[model samples]
Target: MPASHSSYDSGDEPRPRHVAIIMDGNGRWARARGLPRVAGHRQGVEAVRRTIKAAGEAGVEVLTLYSFSSENWRRPRAEVDELMGLLRRYLKSEIADLHGRNIRFRMIGERDGLAADILTLIDEAERMTGSNDAMTLVLALNYGGRQDIARAARNIAESVHRGLLRPEAVDDELFSSYLSTAGLPDPDLLIRTSGEKRISNFLLWQCAYAEMVFIDKFWPDFDADDLAAAMDEFAGRERRFGSTANGR
Candidate 1:
């Protein structure tokens, strides 16, 4: 276990402002129950709803979910189609509710490959919730960390070529501004369900210093308690950010 923050003053122990989750194991969860994988994916949506509510209650400012990864496109066409349909339905049904709750809905990923209708729905959701400040729910759809980085680099190169930016002005801060998550705080805590210890090409740049917690439960089975437990574990860590314990 890491050092606990309990000994510090309440003001000294700040809760994470941003959290990212890798929702995994949906297929396995369905297989275990002798059901179709889509069944687990559907249950995962419910889990997502539960998590959003839980996160709000827990004072999280931003919640980023790995809804669909770039590699997921390689899955069976039927499964991919089902996932896309789920995303479309979720956007249509939840955007209004999210706005009513004062939660901003944002999607981060490559948008060109998505269906035209899905893109339109995404645009509407973002426009509707753009002014909300209660919290942000960022869905990482068709996203990949490496690809994000590559895209940023490409953008920077193009800018430099066009004489819009000097090569000397390029740095970490400038580079990050080009990412899909620009203007958002980096995640302080990252949680991966299904007990997977790897990052799986998610948030490679943004989560550089995040405290990671891996849970054995499948994503569909995750609940508020699970999130609470992970947070409790996070509260026990001392983030030095490359500095020593003595703050040297």
Candidate 2:
């Protein structure tokens, strides 16, 4: 889509092509409830389940969740292990049902620190759901927008040096093709929970023109209704995409 003529700008689509979410405030939610942070994380997983179904129902082709970031590793080792354990359990048990529902699963980010079994499970899930066309659910685990850009830059430079690509050929589309989300459309809507107003380095390049919505509620409290309301808000606005009010 043209920057000046996106689906929203043209009013051609009922909803966004892709919705990206920064699932924040799990620890704070747990702290407020006087419960362990893992409890909130578990509940956040449930929110993910609801959002997946809701996004699919809302006709969103792709849904991306900022499940974990590179900075997340700075946390205590115990918490990290627990989070990894939760991820393991989710993958071990959820893949079959997700496949049956025809929802394709995709994970972006470096897999360097992940366990062998987890990597195997992720590969299997992708292969099994690769053919599904109903919807796509992307999980950004251990992902960093800066790191992604840097990686792509290194690869592009190498390609140029090897005579496989020309430096003059580098452009927005070409750079995007080098990223992890090479084939996926750029997110049209970005949501951050717990009243966070920052993008937090998520989708730094892809969200250049995305409409952002911040929710006051924590990740665990988000539901289908919240998703619907966000879309309604998006629908009411006129996306100019850097154009003037008349889109000239």
Candidate 3:
């Protein structure tokens, strides 16, 4: 596991290298305002833009957003289609801007189920932003924690069966490399909006020791101040990471 950020003192509180967020409550926000759900999602996209700027300004090396989950397929087909359409539009509109900002763009989770046109756009965005080194923005689409783990396990088993990797050679690091987030640092902090406390099947393995901050505001209402507040909360906590506070 990576070193825990909770060990740092106040003055030495290093910015989290990677921050993952579960952007929640778009529908709830819309319902509360008597607006269509897609309106909230549209506003949520604006929040995404602001948060990206905030994270980059805060010196976070990587930002991962849980954009869509595998289980979200259970929603009404119209809603799903609307979300997909929004995603397509976002990619088309934002890729160039992201690349210009020197921000690397990446997507994780299953890709086979996405529409062919969406896949093509994703590929183009990734390729265009591949060389940028300032920071990375990772979107978890069609992702599930259990599914990710299962896929990694299957891949490892196949490698071993093919005589490419010995069973004894399989360890935590090797196993992690087989996961979707192979090259990215584990999240130092994870924030979930709308007061939800659970991880919701996002980054189960990678967030083994990440600090979590839950807020009452919906995704569309989240702003730079809220993000700063979360960071402040993170800065105040002490992370023991299974050891004594004295680091014994």
Estimated TM-score for each candidate: 0.94, 0.94, 0.94
Better candidate number, 2 or 3, judged by lDDT: 3
Identify the candidate with maximal lDDT.
Answer: 1
Per-residue CA lDDT of model 2 for 105-177, tens digit only, reads 9999989998898899999999999999899999898999999999999999999999999889999999999
Model 2 regions more than 4 Å off: 1-13
lDDT of each: 0.92, 0.90, 0.91
What TM-score does model 1 achieve against the real structure?
0.94
lDDT of 1 by residue, 1-248 (tens): 12342322243545788989999999999999999999999999999999998888777899999999999999999999999999999999999999999999999999878999999999999999999999999999999999999999999999999999999999999999999999999999999999889999899999999999999999999998887778877888999987899797
Q: How does residue 207 of candidate 1 score in lDDT?
A: 94
TM-score winner, 2 or 3:
3
Q: Regarding lDDT, does 1 or 3 come out ahead?
A: 1
Number of backbone collisions per candidate: 0, 0, 0
